[model samples]
Target chain A: MIDVLTTAWNWIAEPLQYGFLRQAIWVSAFVGLVCAVLSCYVTLKGWSLMGDAVSHAVVPGVVISYALGIPFAVGAFAFGFGATVAIGYIKSKTRLKEDAVIGVVFTGFFAFGLVLVTKIPSNIDLFHILFGNVLGISRQDIIQTLIAGTLTLAVILLRRKDLLLFCFDPNHAKAIGLNTQMMYYTLLSVLALTIVTALQTAGIIMVVAMLVTPGATAYLLTDRFDRMLMISVAASVSACVLGTYFSYHFDVSTGGSIVVLLTVFFVLAMVFAPKYGLFAQRFRQRVYKKQLDEMSSPP
Target chain B: MTMTASSLDITVDDISVTYSNAKLALYNASCMVMPGTITALVGPNGSGKSTLFKSIMGFLQPSQGKIRVGGFPVQKVQKRQLMAYVPQSDEVDWNFPVSVFEVVMMGRYGYMNIFRTPRQKDRRIVMESLERVGLVDFRNHQIGELSGGQKKRAFLARALAQEGKVILLDEPFTGVDVKTEKRIIDLLLQLKQEGHTILVSTHDLASVSTFCDRTILLNQTILASGTTQEVFTEDNLTMAFGGLPISSLRQMTGQMTGQSSHIVNRQTSQNAEVEA
Candidate 1:
């Protein structure tokens, strides 16, 4: 047992010998924390598809940023915000539902991005942007991630009460003199920025998972919003670390590994969570049925 | 404590709301709710009750008319934290993971600091509001865990915490039990006696005369607006609830006879479905 434990320790510790791997782990963990925080809002607001749409819509911005010799985050945020606005506009103009509008807008943006990537001879790799290259993250990218992540986290936590009310009951928010329209736009902006922060770690494709799975996992685990936020952050950060560790040792895609770990956590919560899990729901139903049976048979 | 007894009369004047889709929800609809009175805004489904409430709350912009509270525009009154609103249950995401206390505390947000960190006084007021609504025992419970009536009371507690003199409730009794409905009506009466102005939209006509001092009959426009004894007549009710069975309308106007009460109750349930 001691030999096996030592071997495992070596497998984990040996990767830390490389500075890039250490940076990758920390950066991905930071990205996970931001995504997890916003994920609580995303999942609670039923904006998982919105997250998916915004993340996919960032691709065109990234390709354009590379072409323009500018930072990708600026381009990514512009495209993400633009897509959100477009979705809202189309939904309002036509009788189409929001989901349908989001679907059409995101795919259009993503396809446009694909065309740009192929048409322009650029140094940017579509594979890296689509699936991420956290292991090869640049120092500049790390700094950008930290700044954007910190801003997003601060805004969410500071305005949590109003945002919570807006998501839970928008009419009440408006009645209380809150500008619900501003809150809506602010949340969308935050979502776009969060996607940008997670872009380097999870890429455009799996970033939605980073923004959705953690919040959903926490949702099943708790019935309180504050605890839900804390649980999602804790679970997501750990998943980031563990997934990065495994990715390094197994030579696997880091984004894919992190998303897989997040899914595993969600599945675990869905099955075994104390309050809202599938098994717990089934158990409560059985208990109620048993009590009904006893009452019918006796009294 | 920002709890002032200063009440304001809500004056909705010829407000017409046309949605972007060109659906005219309310046209030239007007009513006045005096301070220290509970006014019932009675109408059938899609008769612009919700639209009128939204206009008063400054949520939907009126394409033509104006709404003023205490001679001030609705927006000004809202900015003063003198207006509180309780939306219909369908308008809220009940499954949200919020504690009963937190939900009530939302009422104090306008009085709170930018970060919305509740002060000790805010907490005390929230506790008092909960006690007033008989929900103190369930303060820590998840809001979704409550019964339909309890959920309605929780939102009422929130409005109480706001210390608003003018309160607007949209269908507060739709899904609630009779006991809870009585409790809510009693609470509203108590608030009214304390000089608060309340405008409630509901399909439950059987109890309007029991509590409401004034009634506004509306069908896209105000059919009648006056004392409950005058405005809640059979003719006005027929104009508002145009397609409802005459028996149900008669029950509403004929002092809620026991048999008619049953029919009204059934009609109330049907209206809940239609509204949803």
Candidate 2:
């Protein structure tokens, strides 16, 4: 047992000495933080699929930016924002439901991106864009991630109350003289920015998991938004750090490891969370039933 | 408290609204609500009561004509923070993880500068609103955990916290218990006494004569609107309900009698005795 503990300690301690591992850790941590914070709004607004749609829709943008020889962030953000607007426009203009519009638009964007990848002969790394290359990030990538993460996090924190009210009840928000249209677009923009920041660490597919899982897990564990935020950040940061370490030790995909850890956390919270957990609720129900039986059959 | 000059006197002039699918919701609806009175908007299920309120609240754009509040256009009045709307409780997502306090504090968002947090004044107002609605003890409770009546009261508390000169409520009495209904009536009377203009949409005709100083009977248009004694007659009700069954009319008359019995006791009761 001591030997196993010693090896585990060394495994975590040795990664601290490497610059690349350190960069990967910090980058993933930042991505996790922003994604988790924004995830609360996304989940509360019932926009989980919207987050998926925007993330997937960025592939063509990334590919186009590479072809244009511009920065990937610019193209990714443009496409992310464009996808959200398109979704909103389609939802508003037609009778189609929001999820259907999102599905059609994102699938079209993803297919277009795949076709572009096949057509282009550039040296753009399709695999890394699709699944991420967190361990291989450079110093410039760290700076970009830092800037994006900080801006997104700050905006979310600053507008947390307004955003919460807007998501919870938009009509009330508008009735109270809030420009709900502005709030809507602001949330969409934040979502796009968060997705863009997370693109490098979790990539398109896994980024949605990072954006959704932490908030969902925290939701199961708490009834208050403030506590939900704290728990989501803690859960996401721990998953990012531990998953990075695990991936390094096992030679697995870092994004995959992080997503797996997030899923584990969600499952645990679902089963064991104090109030809303499955077992806790069932246990309460049984106790109540017992009390009812006692009351009904009293001497 | 002195009545502000901005206490809104709502005026809907020849306004009409059509849904996107081309269904006419309201047709040249017109009414006037004087300041410092609780006006009940009475109509059947699809009589455009909510549509009129929405248009007046600037939620719907009327296809024709205009709506003015406090001598200003609805939009301008809204921008000036002179109006508050409380939609049906069912329209809200109760499962949202907001506390009763947070939900009520949202009322102060209109008066708050963007990017500014709620101050001590805002907190005190929220607390007072909660106390008025009798939910101060439940301030920290999750909104979803509240009973249905409590949810309605919470929204009422939110509207009170807005401190608007004009308040529009969409069916505040629906689905609430008797105690909550009475509390809302008492609160409406208090607000009216405080010089706040209140327009409430309701199907409860009994409470209309008891509480509302004025009532607007609508059926795709204003059939009758004046003091409850003038507008809430059986004739106007029959027009609003598209020939409401005589049985329902008798029940309404029974309620107007203030008798504890639920049976339809009289069809020829004096209208003067029924008028509040």
Candidate 3:
């Protein structure tokens, strides 16, 4: 037992010797926390598809930023924000529903990004941009991610109550003079920034999972928004830390490992949650049915 | 608790609203609600009742004309916290993870500081509002756990906590039990006695004459407006309901009245008194 324990400890401690691995772990945890916090709002507001659309839509912006020798986040945020605006504009202008508009706009932007990737010089690594390279992330990219993530976190925390009211009932929010339009734009902008923040850690293809899975898992476990927020942060941060360790040992993708863990947690919560889970619902129904049978038996 | 009487009245002057899709919702709609009175805005399903409410609350900008509260512009009145609105049940997400207490606490948002941290007074008022709606026991329960009537009562508690001089409720009685309906009517009457101006939009015509001091029959525009006794006539109701005869209208009210023995007795007594 002592030998096994020592081996496990060595496996954990050996990675800390490398500066890049240490930075990767810290960056992963930070990105997980920021995405998890915003995920609560995204899940509750029924904006999961919006998160997906915005994340995928940032690919062209990253390519453009690479071509122009500028910061990737600035260009990525612009396109992400622009995608949301275009979706809104088109939905208002045409008779199409929001989901259809989101589908068309995101696909068009992603296809345009693919074409740009093919035509650009080979200096840019398309694989890293699509699937993330957190283990090999640079110091500058880390700083950019942290700054964007912190700003998004601050705005969400400061305006938490009004945003909650807006998501729950926009009409009532307006009735209370809370400026629902401003709240709408604030939420959309922060969502765009959050996508940009997660881009370096989770990449465009996997970032939507980072933005949606934790909150969905937390939602199943609790019936209070405050508790839900805390649970999501805890779940996501732990997933990031553990998934990075596992990925290092197994030589696998870090973002993929973390998202897989998040999905597993969501499934566990869905099946076994105390109050609203599938098992609990079935258990309640069975008990009620037994009582009915007993009563019908001439008691 | 005695509420200070409000002397403010609501006036909508020839307001017209057109949606972004070029759908004209309301055209030249106008009405006046007096303070210290309960006025009913009666209309059909697609008759722009909600659009009118939105215009009055300044949620939708009217293409022409204006709305004023106590001789002040709608925007200025809103800034002064002079209005509270209760939208229909379908307008909210029931599955949101907010407690009944938290939902009612939202009414005090206008009174909170920048952080929206509730003061002791806000907590006390939230409790009092819950008590008023008889949902104090369910304060900590998630809103989705509540029954249909309980949900309506919770929203009513929120409106009560708002402490706005002018209250507009759209379809407050729909999907509620008779007991809850009685509770709502009683609360509205109490607010009327306190000199608050109330505008309630509902298709439930039976109860309009039971308590409302004035009624505005609406079908795209004001079909009739005056005291309930004058405007709630069979002809005006027929026109407003799109040619439903007086017999079916009475039957609708009668079927609704038959749901509760208490309301039936009171309605019969009131009808006998009217006949006498």
Candidate 4:
């Protein structure tokens, strides 16, 4: 057991000396951090389904970009953003329900991606875009993640009020002459950009888990928006570092390891955090019921 | 668009609204809100009070004539600095993760440049508006923590931050406790004193006479509108509620017996009078 552990340690420690591995670690950390921040509002707004929808909707763009050998992120962004805008437009102009719109657009995109994947079956990197390759993370991917993360932060900080109003009391925002359409698209675009940055290191499936779990876990800890974002980032960064380390030592898929790491953190938060955590919530309800019985019976 | 028409009044003339569901919610609604007064719009359920309020607030464009706010046509009066709206409820996602102060600061959106953040003056206005609503301590509290009444006050604070010449409220008192209701009414009265034109939709007939300067009674259309005393007459009340009176069906035939418009059952007519 000691020999096996030492071997595992040597394999992981060796990668630290290489620039490529360093870039992979940096990229994952940035993606995790940005996603954690953005997820605060997303979770609060009960749009927890957002990461699932937005990430899946980027499928067709990934297929097209790969087919044409173009910058995949560009195609993915435009298509992701286009799909988001289309859903928003349909929601605005038609009386159709939002969930129906999301389902139709997202499924259609996923199907298109699947078809592309089938066509490229024999390739070693065939489904790499979906599962990701954190082990093979590149310098260009790191730059891409960094730039998108920075831009996402900048936009959120700058238009904090407009975005807050748009999310909270949209009718009042409209009545006061805020262009609802413009604000809607601006948020969708930011969502698209955030997804694109996350697509590289964590990829589609695990990236979504990373995006949602940390924020949800953090939500168990605080009720303030700014603090929620901060805690989410902290949770995500911690998960990313731990997951990367474990992936290296265990000789497993980094993407899968990262998702597992995040899920564990979320479970811990659910059971342990104060007040609204899952276990605490149930326990509190029991105590409150007991107190009510004591007060009401013959009193 | 700003309502710079040298008057602070709203006038809806020959306006009609039909819902997308093909129901004519309003039929030729018309009224005038004079300057510097609180005009209470009252009616029974399904009445066009909310419809009229929506038309005046430019939320609904009428199919017929126009509704002007402060002499500025509804289409042209889309200026944030001159007009603000208070909804009955903040039904938007409470999970939106905004503090009360952040929500109120959004009132300055129109005055801001496309990429601009809130100015110091704008922040000050938001702070004062929060203070006005007695939610200064809750400025940094997440919206999810607020009770229903506090939620309404937060919205009102957002409107107050607009510093508008006019405020249009839609059933603003719903779900609010009586103490909070009175505080809101007091705040509206204060707004009136500041020369703001206030129009509010209400279902409470009892409170109209006490606080409102005038009342517009509507039932799918304008039934009667004028001072509270002028509009709440028995004749208008009958028309506003409906033509049939329950007393006509009551066990009393008393004096309404033989000289009535139609005949009653001969056997029950005498008993009805006795039971009267």
What's each prediction's clash count?
Answer: 0, 0, 0, 1
Q: What lDDT tens digits, residue by residue, belong to model 2 across residues B55-164?
A: 88887789998988888887677676688888897788877888999989988887777775889989999999999989999999999999988988898888888888
Tell me the chain A TM-score of model 1. Answer: 0.97
Q: Candidate 2, DockQ to 2 decimals?
A: 0.54
Greater lDDT among 2 and 4 belongs to 2
Per-model TM against the reference: 0.94, 0.93, 0.94, 0.82
Off by over 4 Å in 4: A1-14, A92-95, A117-126, A282-299, B1-7, B13-28, B46-55, B58-66, B73-80, B90-96, B108-127, B135-148, B234-276
Specify the highest-DockQ model's number.
Answer: 1
For candidate 4, the docking band is acceptable
Q: Tell me how far candidate 1 lies from the true structure as C-alpha RMSD in angstroms.
A: 4.8
Clashing pairs in 4: A44-B95
For residues A69-140, could you state the per-residue lDDT of candidate 3 as single tens digits?
999999999999999999999998898899999999999999999999999974668888888889989888
- Candidate 3 displacement at residue A120 in angstroms: 3.3
lDDT tens digits, residues B109-195, model 1? 988887899999999999999999999999999998999999999999999999988899999998888899999999888888788
State the lDDT of candidate 3 residue by residue for B1-276, as single tens digits.
Answer: 347654688888888888878888877877788776899988999889998998999888899999999998877777677888887898878889999999999999988886799999999999999998899999999999999889988998898888888889989999998988998999888888777889999999888878888877777777767766666555556677866766788676554323332332312322211211
For model 4 the local lDDT of residue A202 reads: 80
Question: Which 10-residue span in candidate 4 chain B carries the lowest summed lDDT?
Answer: B267-276
Model 1 in CAPRI terms: which quality? medium
Local distance difference test values of all predictions, in order: 0.87, 0.84, 0.87, 0.75
Model 3 CA deviation exceeding 4 Å by range: B1-5, B253-276
